[model samples]
Target: MSVTDEILTPRGPARVDTDVPAGAPVALLVLGHGAGGGVDAPDLLALRDAAVAAGLVVVRVTQPYRVAGRRAPAPAGHLDEAWSVVLGVLRDRHTGLPLVVGGRSSGARVACRTATTVGAAGVVALAFPLHPPGRPERSRAAELGTGLPTLVVNGDRDPFGVPESGPDVRVVTRPGERHDLRGDPSGTAAVVRDWLRDRGWTPA
Candidate 1:
């Protein structure tokens, strides 16, 4: 079952929906939605189901602006601050389990920016926006790896550009997907499992 929680952050009230595996969890995944989306995105829901069945706790977070019924995303600093607050609240609740931070689009960028500070074991970026459309000078690839094992799933035709793979980064492309990744996320979930296995992590 999934439960929603209202978390107070510096910016506003953010919401999170959490799902846990039937058995003991091996790790926890904290996923954030994109700038214009909510926690109910198809990709997010798919990931949540896949991870839960594989014995992980999954939490989908809606940013403060989204919770307030705003379409425009908050500033990067505000987003990051709110995310930090959310983690602070969940940290004690899931102590001793490894945390993997992840998100889609702009949320993916936020995860990358905050992973190091939170000591995340991994990052899952779905349709990561490498740079704005028609703008290559504002590259955000440096945030991709962040000195941790990372998995990036993207659409082959995404206007955001194809993200490059590095030693710490593994990129998976969906032939028919666009930036939305519009369909089941089982493939991306399997990629996430493989990445964890490569790092010697297995579901309990």
Candidate 2:
């Protein structure tokens, strides 16, 4: 079963849909949506299902901007601030469990940027926008330097470009998919599930 909550943030009210496993969860996974998307994005939903089945509590967040019915994303600082507030509340609810944060595209960037501040143990960045489309010079790869284990999943054909693997970061590419990653959400979820298992965040 899923429980929904509306959280008050600095910018506005943010929404979260949470799913907990039947038994004790190995960890708590908090996910955010892309700039223009919501918590129901295919990839996010698939990961939620997989993570719950793997005995992890999953919470998908809908940003304040999106919750307010806006298609345009808020400024990066605003997004980060609101995200931090939401995470703080979630931490209080699921205390003692390892916290893993992540999301797709802009949400992924937010997660990476605030991972250390929120004391996240790991990050899962799906379809991370390496840079604005056709703007390789504007690289945001530096944001991925959280010094924690991170998993990045991107479609081979994503216009956003794929990030390269780093010492503590693992990048998985799904061929024939794009920025949306709708082609094989299950496959993307499988990769995440395996990564969690490798990190001992979930049962093998």
Candidate 3:
């Protein structure tokens, strides 16, 4: 089943669309959208469906700025603050469930920044923007060093450079895909599903 709820954050009101599996959920996977997109991005939708099928509760978050109809994203600090609040609320509602946080692009960055603060068991970073297009010097790879198990799926052809694997980070490249991963969202979802299964977060 699916439910939509509003959450008050430090910045403003955020939205969460939750999908629960028919059976008891093995884990809770929270996802956010890219700076230029909403919760309905093809990859997010696919991840939601896949996680739900794998007996995981999936929550797609619409940040406060997006809820207020703004295409531009809030500042990183603001975004992280709001996300922490939302995660706290969700944790209260579903206590004892392992929490995995993730998102695409800018959203992925937010998840990484707040993973430790929010106490996420793991992170799923879809299309993590390693650096701004054509600017490798300004690498944001440090964000992926959350000290938590992180799965980073990126398009091999992304203009935004792909991040390299670290001690706690695993990088998965989708062939012929771009930053959006729209070329094969299901394939992207499959990689996530396998990762979850490997971690014993989902039924094998």
Candidate 4:
């Protein structure tokens, strides 16, 4: 149960914490906090723990703005930099294993963008904020790309609801789960594990 903590100190300060096995069917999954919560938030913790139990290495991090204790998000440029630095660390640290990078809300958005360009093995987007609740006109669903294995665990009652219009999108909707995937750890864990396996990241 040993974990490594690396402080990424490039543009802004951030902490990258991970739990992984020394030698197993390893997959490095990097998660970011939501706009409102840090990595220690309960929902993120549950998902991180679940991934670890499923035998994939789990890396949780705080955005630079969040690390600075800012309630609002940082400018787009800074946030993007933070993601790149953290992912670079993941690439270096977990060499020879598949890499899965994603986040909660904005973090997931960043990961979705990065994955398409960076060629991550897969993506796990928990509580993706599709359109910012009631603003469907400004949709973020387009950020998701094709050809990569993606697992989106969102709540049935989530504000943007399910985007029932796309192919190759695996959607797991928890009955009462909100944008936070609240009260749905079991369901979340199952889908994520299955998704990891689908992407060739099975437990050893």
> Against the unseen true structure, what C-alpha lDDT does each candidate score?
0.87, 0.95, 0.95, 0.75
TM-score of each prediction: 0.95, 0.99, 0.99, 0.89
Where is model 2 more than 4 Å wrong at Cα?
none
Output the lDDT of residue 105, model 3.
98
Query: Over all chains combined, what TM-score does candidate 4 have?
Result: 0.89
Specify the poorest-scoring 10-residue window by lDDT in model 3. Answer: 1-10
Better of 1 and 3 by TM-score: 3
TM-score for candidate 2, residues paired by index:
0.99
lDDT of 1 at 101: 93
How badly does each model clash, as a count of residue pairs?
0, 0, 0, 0
lDDT tens per residue, model 1, 1-204: 789888999898989898988888888899999999887888888888888887788999899999889999899999999998998787778998899999999999999999988879889999999989989888889888698989899999888877989998989988888898875477766777777666655543
lDDT of 4 by residue, 51-76 (tens): 77777788888787777778899876
Q: Write the per-residue lDDT of candidate 3 for residues 1-204, one digit (tens) a residue.
A: 569989999899999999999898999999999997998999999999999999999999999999999998889999999999999999999899999999999999999999999999999999999999999999999999899999999999999989999899999999999999999999999999999999999987
Q: Which ten residues in a row have the lowest lDDT in candidate 1?
A: 195-204
